[model samples]
Target chain A: MSATVYIPREATALSLGAQSVARALAEEAARRQDAVQIVRTGSRGLFWLEPMLEVATSAARVAYGPVQAADVAGLFEAGFLTGGKHRLNLGPVESIPYLKNQERLTCGRLGVIDPVNLDDYRAHGGYAGLTNALAMEPAAIVKAVTDSGLRGRGGAAFPTGIKWKTVHDAPGAKKYIVCNADEGDSGTFSDRLLMEGDPFCLIEGMTIAGLAVGATSGYVYLRCEYPHAQDTMTQAIATAYAAGYLGADVLGSGRAFELQLRMGAGAYICGEETSLLESLEGRRGQIRFKPPLPALKGLFGCPTVVNNVISFASVPIILERGAQFYKDYGMGRSRGSLPIQLAGNIARGGLVERAFGVTLRELLYDYGGGTRSGRPIRAVQVGGPLGAYWPESKFDTPVDYEAFAGGGGMLGHGGIVVFDDTVDMAAQARYAMEFCAIESCGKCTPCRIGSTRGVEVIDRLVAGDRTAMQQTLLRDLCDTMLNGSLCALGGLTPYPVLSALDYFPEDFSTPAALQAAKR
Target chain B: MSERKRVTIPIRVEPGTDLPAAERTAVLEAVNQNRALEGSLLPILHAIQDRLGWIPPRTLPLIAYELNLTRAEVHGVVTFYHYFRQHPPGKQVIYLCRAEACQAVGAVSLEAHAKRALGIDFHGTSGDGRYTLEPVYCLGNCASGPSLMIDRELYGRMTPERFDDLIAADAAGATSAAATSAGATRA
Candidate 1:
């Protein structure tokens, strides 16, 4: 028998027809009785063409994809076993534009090795970070992460190393490491993609965190929206446990760190770290006050390191390769690569991890290839629902946190949603308040009640109350939500609402009937 | 043995919603089964739609009851989520992703085109009672933007022209089935 091949059984691959491709390759290998093995590895982030297949050649592993089962026979006949090609030639998988352009820090091992095979992960540079981390003083490791300039990728851009150090220093007998996989943003799926595409990186990142913080337990609070991700991560965790990479006395270091999966109920508020902690304790998810910040009194009142999947996934690489290597990629203050999730109304949408400071023009025109409708671009929502809306004129804004912030957009989770000319900014603004009203944890007054009132004001404006006085009132309402709300949910809701008013005033002046109010 | 946790919180009911028992049970079942899911609200609502065909007002309390959650908790989930329906949906679901990705690609015009051709407003059912339309955020088919989900299958890079053809074909399919179902439901 030839060497066994394994590939990802994740949903993205399923959606891309990996099942049929794998089956076809198997049948072809069988017919020839060739001693060749075909493995279905997880996606390598080049999701543009799926059914992406890789072959173990004598020279290097060759890749081909967006392949149909119909093409398998031709591929086999074309000496594909020897790296020859039929039609689906993507020449060295690593060289593909989508793969090569990415400065994959967190997703480095994804789509590269067999997710189920621990041996494969080891061969391709897995667990190296954990070994390196274990050898160092926890303080040294923390210093390296802090110097790397990595921030939380799950909406909030809090410095990850600072959070870890706080939890590490917090006085507590029991501590915890929690991976927030509760990615509930409307235009975001990077967390799910990372977990399913490269589960090990996250595991390694969490293990490193546990060791750094003297925590004995870690929990991955994954959202249910990603059923496939949940199953894939669970399997990866099991494999890690079996191989002694996790569980008691990991890798003979005598360091005990146990990890478990805590599924979240479908509350967007749960994406907030403290609420996630409460949910892990098996209670209803509601946002808690800050200052006690999760690092001090989190997860059953024990010091906890709560981080998003991407932030934790970034740790292993920083530990293994050192902070300088990671720090070399990004621009200005945002020193590291960001796995920017390109989504919504664009021609080409997918994850693009580049050094920060890429312009919106590049993201939209060059990478996204303009709108799918071949129409004029209108507005873009940078960040998630709580992020700001920018008109076409503001496309010059750079993606760095400071730059985006200066341009009135917070780089929340790096989710950029493009809109074409046909968009009604007014209606989209209304949706912002509506979404806030629906998702507000109701712990704060501004978010709990202001969101509903905000929606009504927008509704009234749309219903022909576009008088100058009324418009001013609407603007004032947005400011209240902006300043008064506790979290970004309320604080940033005005970004979209106000931006719509500022850039698309024509949309606000309700048809002729509504214009009468202005007169 | 794991201890059962008991927690209680007050909840508010929406202004107007009084549904029957069966509908409530169906909604609750969907919510309870899915509550523990990370980002579960949308999928739970989707499940409720699959089970009971619509989201009834009473489903909120029922969901609260089963999950040991408050009425506001259930209400927040049901209303916060865009997928759930407080009223009955028509036979087929045609949800368009209107988030920036789709909009950047022309989903706005397509939505207008769809609404005009279908003769139904956004979030409204067709007059013939065959299709219910709704707006969604994103489906993660970013590379193929301007996408729509008919039932659960994502159709990407859609244009008003292509959607017209799709709607025509769908209308043809709906007509034959509607003829039979309409007769049965009305009769």
Candidate 2:
């Protein structure tokens, strides 16, 4: 009989030699005159331990981690197919501490099933939400979500149900439900994982949104950087259309909803809702003025509901388990589970989906296992590029949206990038400004010209010209960018730059000056 | 200090003149295939670039004509996006993630090594037309830092040594050449 072997088809897995490992497993099996069936599944999000391989045992799925192509022969020789012991064996998949501790609501099906298999999805609790949603009134669905305390997971912390309610109440010839999958954040992969791993969750979520908002049309504005995600999502969408989870009659509910996958050409600003709307309309991704919120008039002047992948993906479970099940998990105003990504120079970096209020210290030490270099951690940048650089003193702060905002940091998209003691905060601050300059839509002068000037000021400061006049100028520039800019791309850039300057002022001083002052 | 907002190459061409005859047909075919899509300009531009590796100057007017927009409107849209190339790339395009995640794991050093080895900076192709280097903000492989993508294939946890070896292997045809050929055939 042939043994079943599982490998991840996810992006990070493929990037880390999963393809070659799969090939080696097959070739080695054939050469030994033994048969092996390879099952491609989504990643479990223990990314540093990829391409993690699993074998189907009768009792459980036995896991082996960080496997290279070179480990194939020795593994077979050790009788590893039947869950026999090997040096690299990570035991059962569920027993792993990092994955075991996670409270996976939206991400429950990730890495647990064959990604593109709709039957496999149904075998799991795939469309239970839609099934229940089809029986309920649309207003009740909106009220359930609103009562569940589900806010937009895409950094802004807006109430998801309120946006849906706005779209639900608005009258238009056509309404839209747009999933902002343009995840351009530097240290975030939660959106990509869900899209590639459990795409049906997003589809079901979108269907529920369409039903709630009376929108018949939908679009997923995905970034061009994620071609692997595009391939997986496209396949999943085709599967969905075939299975009646999408298209004119969703799950035979006698209602209509249609979805189209749209590609965004490499503009980070498109992650912003208004700019994304502009790009979806085939125009330049420039920031639009407010008073016409996207909920009121969006997507070619129609009432559109734009939500992030995580936000949309969270909807299915909210609908299935009802409101209070989700509301009971989180803390304070920020309710429901938060999927936090740990990246950069961390010892064990991956996605950690937990209820809100988990502290930074716990995420960094208990889960992340400290820096990958085994050095003292100096700084950690919470949120994406526009988030604040928190110091060691602030490690105990809980990962609540309001808590972070109160502490001069915002948990933007829940991505945390760590840096060791060797990192230069001054250079990081300059890079933040430079990143703003590169991705800015050039609509407002504050972000367009202010970022360039900010970079020059940081350069001058670190180049030993740290005069008070220059420092004041830098502060004033950040203030202008914060208050005067049109969008968050311009408005929130000071979060990183000023946070760096405030947290690590020594980094802004030249090495010579530092040496002299220390003496 | 400039945003690299517009294409550096001045675009001026008649609809039926100075364009490669075969690619023009391919361009028109791409436009027609996507003309019915909502906000189809981006889809058309992507199709042309995917088939030909870059959008030709003359093809812009053709796309505009098919989409019922002006040549300048089409031109503005194409230049606004970073993915659509105005000039042809080399046989193999290398995208190195220079974002903060990759930087934390030694992307800067690897970037310098790649530049020195290739004898060209970012957005510059080698004299042999074998390689073109582009800086990608993020490929979302954050845990395994210093990610590099050669054509459509992605590699992670890259070091200067590994980068050198991989590109050498690419030059020697050890890696898949399908993406390269599909992009290079009409360029």
Candidate 3:
């Protein structure tokens, strides 16, 4: 009998040499005439242990990893095919502390099943939510989502149920469900992970949204950067259509729900809901003024339920288990598990899914195991580029939306990028302004002009010219961009700048001090 | 830097210069495949770029004419997007991640090393027309910092040595193709 060996085909794992490892395994098996079958699955989110190969034993799946192609010959020589002893062997993947400790509601099936196989997905409890949602009334479905306390996982923290109910009640003959898969935020890959690892969950979630609202059509506005994800999703969509999970009638319910995938051409602003809608309509991605919410007037001038990829992907679980069962996991107003991506300069950087109350200190030290460079951790940036640079002092803040917001930070896409003591806060601040300047949709002046000026001001400060005055001017410029901008692109650029100035004033002042001392 | 502010600076095309017959026919076919869909402009632009190497200056008018849109509108979109190349690209394109996550773990140094090695800045093609360097905001491989992409294949945890090897391999492939073509010419 042939034993099945699991190798991750996800982008991150592939980048870290999973493809070469898979090839080596195949070649070695053929050379030895060994009966071994290789199956490509998604990463278990333990990125540091990538090329993490698994062998299915009668009892459990044995694991080995951070494996390279060069190590394959040695692994085979050590009789690793039937889970023999090797230096890389991590017995029974479920026993690994990094993955075992956390709650994985949304990502339960990630890295577990073959992403494109319909039967594998169903066996692991994939469409149970859609099945349950199919039996309920639209209002009941909306009420269930609301009762579960699910909010937009895309940083906004807006209640998902309320958004659905608005679209459900809105008087529109045609409505649309648009999944915001344009995850342009740096250090964030939960959306990409979900889309690539288990695309059926996203499809099921969107279908539930389509049924909840009267929307007959859905679109996933995915960014072009994710070519692998695009291929995976496209294949998954085709599979769903073949299985009658999509197209003219979903699960033979006699209701039509059509889904299409559209690619965005390298625009960061399009991650915003309105801008995404504009890009979907085949126009430049520029932020539109709010007041007429997308739930009221959206894509093609119809009510639209524009939710993030994670938000939609989280829906299946809410329906599969009752709302109360899911809601019981989280703290405060923030309900359910938040998939936090630990990235950049961290020892064990990967996806960590836990209930909302997990502290930054716990996530950084416990799960992350400090900086990869082994340097003293100085600061961490929660969220993306637009999020604040949190000093060590603020590490106690919980992962909840309100807790983060109260501490002058955001849980934007729940991406945390750690920086060691070697980091220069001033340069990071300058980068924040520079990023805003580059990606700003030219529609708003404060974002357009203010960001450019902010870059110049930071440059002047860095060059040791009139530091005190520039610091004050930088704050004022941030205020203007904060209050006058149309969207978060302009409004949130100040978070990093102001936080840098406030948290690490010494770095900004050192240049001036050095200049004065030299004089 | 001053040139960056302009939304649409019209490309200078010599008078009476048209796209080659085969390329023109391919563009028309690509446009026809998507013209019936609502908001077909972006997809049409993508198709043209896919069919041809890049969106030619002469083809914008052709696209506008077929899609019932103005030439200015088509020009605006091509310029607005960073992905759409204004000119034909080299044999391979490399997109380096320049976002904050990458920078946190040595992307800045990688960018400098890549620029020095390639002998071209961002958006510049190599002198031998073998490579084009571009900057992408993020590639969603932030867990492994200092990520880059050649064509569509992503590479991460890159060092200067590894980068040099990758470029060398690509150059070797280009040389072999050139050699084959030269042999074909002799035959």
B1-187 in candidate 3: lDDT tens per residue?
4566657887754321376886688678887898777677778788777767688877777777777778898898888778888888888889999988788788889999999999999999999998899999999999898898865677888888888978877666753321111012111
The digit string of per-residue lDDT tens for model 3 on A1-519 reads 588999987888888888778878999999988899898887888999987999998878889998998999998898787888999999999889999999999998888889988899999999999999999999999999999999999989899999999999999899999999999999999999898889999999999999999898999999989987887898899999999999988989988789988888898999999999988887888878887999999998899999999999999989998899889988899999999999889999999999999999999999999988899889999989899999998999999999999999999899999888989999899999999998998999999999999999998877767777888899999999999999999999999999998999888867565685477
Give the alpha carbon lDDT tens digit for every residue of A1-519 in model 1. Answer: 464444445445554556666776788888889776666566665555666677766666677777767888898788776678667877777777666777777777777777767888778788889999999998888888999999888867888889989988888999999999888776677787788767888899999999888999999987654556766788889999998989998999999989887665456777888777766765556778887888999888889999999998888888889999988978888878888876766666677888887888988888878865678778888888878888888888887888888887788888888777878888888988887887788788988898999898887777776566667787888778888888778888888888888888889876753557646
Model 2 superposed RMSD (Cα): 5.7
Q: Where in model 1 is the C-alpha error above 4 Å?
A: A1-10, A28-36, A77-81, A85-87, A513-519, B1-141, B145-187
- Considering just chain B, what TM-score does every model have? 0.67, 0.85, 0.82
Q: Considering TM-score, where higher is better, how would the candidates rank from best to worst?
A: 2, 3, 1
Scoring model 2 with DockQ, what do you get? 0.38
Off by over 4 Å in 3: A516-519, B1-17, B174-187
lDDT string, candidate 2, A243-303, tens digits = 8888888877789989989999999999999999999999889979986999999999999
TM-score of each: 0.79, 0.95, 0.95
Q: Which candidate number would show the highest TM-score if scored against the true structure?
A: 2
Q: Which candidate is the best by DockQ?
A: 2
Q: Which of the predicted structures, 1 or 3, would earn the higher DockQ when compared with the native? A: 3
After superposition, the stretches of candidate 2 with alpha carbons farther than 4 Å from their true spots are: A512-519, B1-14, B177-187
